[model samples]
Target: MPSVAEGVKLGIQECQHQFRGRRWNCTTIDDSLAIFGPVLDKGRKLRNWTKRRQAREQGSTPPAATRESAFVHAIASAGVAFAVTRSCAEGTSTICGCDSHHKGPPGEGWKWGGCSEDADFGVLVSREFADARENRPDARSAMNKHNNEAGRTTILDHMHLKCKCHGLSGSCEVKTCWWAQPDFRAIGDFLKDKYDSASEMVVEKHRESRGWVETLRAKYALFKPPTERDLVYYENSPNFCEPNPETGSFGTRDRTCNVTSHGIDGCDLLCCGRGHNTRTEKRKEKCHCIFHWCCYVSCQECIRIYDVHTCK
Candidate 1:
């Protein structure tokens, strides 16, 4: 069983990988940890802000949750699950090992006897660790818990069985199979899609027979209740184009951008109409490679100058 710290590190790596091209990329791991702390201390502060804003609004346009927050919640939860499951398969922990118990029955010219990755154990441990921190009986706590569980659920739903055939000269005389978890990158990609469609939730206090109960309702009505697999949030994100220490935004000033790109990473979008400064930069590279007989290759050094653009 890897320590909680290792799990957090893995989660941070995944967050950076998933949001590498986004405006609010996960560059400051420490700041992220502060926001998504064990008890979500920073998140709690945001929730308090939400309450104050609602009080002033008198129940109109409650709050728009930020996609960055949703992504963090999902990726962090998924990171823990991915790391623990991978560690189990690698025999890094003595407490648990590969999931051999779920192997399929023998026959059909194949045997399901390999050490399958134990994703269920990963999910169990993740829930115990991540969900335990959210002990608050409030809407924000509930929302975080739901997003964390959704991350684990995404991993389990994507797991698949892999098989290898063995025989004379690679014939299909016999086969070995095992359950495998999808690559962490794939999980990250899936969650990125979920983040894109994340929903804004309405957390309201309702009177119940027992007492006052906090309810999490989707802002928009859907054909069915919001899926547990969807990411949900309760507050809008700050404009990341300018520095805002309070909201943790460092701004995009001087950030390098693709002049030809029309996406978020492009100058037009990333600079937020601030325009950009262009300058020529010299870059060095190895080029003109040649393969030698025995088993060697050679290349000549090359230099090229290109125009680099940065947000003004």
Candidate 2:
């Protein structure tokens, strides 16, 4: 898919198509732009376009950078009711893509002041920029590195930087902030509506099936998590029998069976036990729908007397 600029270009081209249908002159595009949607928001782009059009009328080409910027502006300006509460200044960290912390994934980010996409959506842009600069894709490579390494560059690294606040949360200065979208949620009707859909999903895939496993995993993922403590590493073994000492919490355990943070009973949490390799025996007569484990046993029938020899 094209960037937000590309999407805007397409939208503008659509407006041009509509304007041509009415057989109106295409000399001044501003009127057509407004009819289609928001022509300009910050006034910076609007001002630039005015000058560029005037310059072109004088038979001189606009500066290369200015032309590119104006074209990108035209693409973005084709949106509906775009509002730029802010703009870029020298002091603030402007990045390779020129997207500020206030801005987002260009195409859809500006549509509603609430861009519709996933957290990793920015990754695509980062990869594109990196490809242009020949940099690496890892967050570290995309961050403060002056030398673009593995063809990956993006504006996301600045988001994770520590804010000038004493608390651990995001900048305390912001209230109903624009940058904090992926995690933000409105109360009242909004929450109710979102929950309504998710609730239906939960009921449709009720527990006692694989849904139970998925639900359990999602519930665990939502946990806020406690601070790090003196965690250690140990392995649960077939012959070895031991329980966690410092913390009883399965979450704050010292070590894991496997490094991957997957199924609790997998390489994570406690080991799967000696059950990994075991043998089973079939009843000589019939199982009688009964099962036993060492001293523990279950049966459909109950005998009043104990059979010492038969029990084993």
Candidate 3:
């Protein structure tokens, strides 16, 4: 449970880091435990049973299955697997530990001596627990499951052979190698790339012998199909130029933007062509630090002024 909590925290931090320049910024709602505020809210209307039924019968699209949601699901799942695998390697959990089942002999100069982080165990734990609640037959469930697996897949794909050298005078006579997960930042970067190239999917519904069946298919035939490691979403992302309660977009109001950038984070785009407000502020910082001979250091204070631009 502690590992799980740590994983959630890790995912949130990574989300914020990756999207800090974007409109959403992965802001968390203070009053709700849904984390990224109402961006991922789906069941809010479920409390009213009539609306839920109408939504199901009419096949109305829910605002929860956007590309941002896909990224969130993938990152969260990856975080859980990463944290659990790390904990298992550290022997923090009694039920799981290092992977001792690595078969075959070692390489010419290295042997598998150290504990290998059990990524399979972590993936299994994440799959069984994280995917258990998404057992519904709807397309949303399928989308969530696919993104979750993609996250876990990122962890597995990034596992590398980590080794330690052994010998006198730091000379490498032999090395002990073990499988280890990559840094979480690397995983986040990979997933962010995936997010950029995420596939747009369409929900295909059909009448089956059992009942109504729904599956996701690529929206465009011109593009390549999304693989298991790729992220997919059934709906388009919100433009995020203005406050939208339905899509949970807080808008770019007061958001800082890069004046030189022409991308989404640029002032022109982020401010939605309404222009921006600029302000000059003074900031004091430590400057001209010099190390003393006695291993101490001292610095002089400096005042700096710069123009800050924010969305109107």
| Candidate number with greatest TM-score | 3
Clashing pairs in 3: none
What clash count does candidate 3 reach?
Answer: 0
Q: lDDT per model, in order?
A: 0.73, 0.24, 0.81
lDDT of candidate 2 over 174-208, digit per residue (tens): 32223421111111122222212221101012355
Error of 3 at 236 (Å): 1.1
The numbered model that scores best in lDDT is 3
- Report the Cα lDDT for residue 41, model 2: 17
The list of candidate 3 runs beyond 4 A from truth reads 31-39, 42-62
TM-score of each: 0.85, 0.16, 0.88
lDDT of 1 by residue, 1-312 (tens): 344557667766787776655566665523334436622323222434344432331111111246676677777777788788888888888888999777547768888867899999988988887787677667767888888898899989999888899999879898888889987888888988998888888889977777777768888786356699998887777657775434645567777788999998899988888999999989999999999998999999999999999888
What's the distance in Å from true for residue 175, model 1? Answer: 1.3
Q: Is candidate 1 or candidate 2 better by lDDT?
A: 1
- lDDT, candidate 1, residue 91? 85
lDDT of 3: 0.81
Error (Å) of candidate 2 at residue 15 is 16
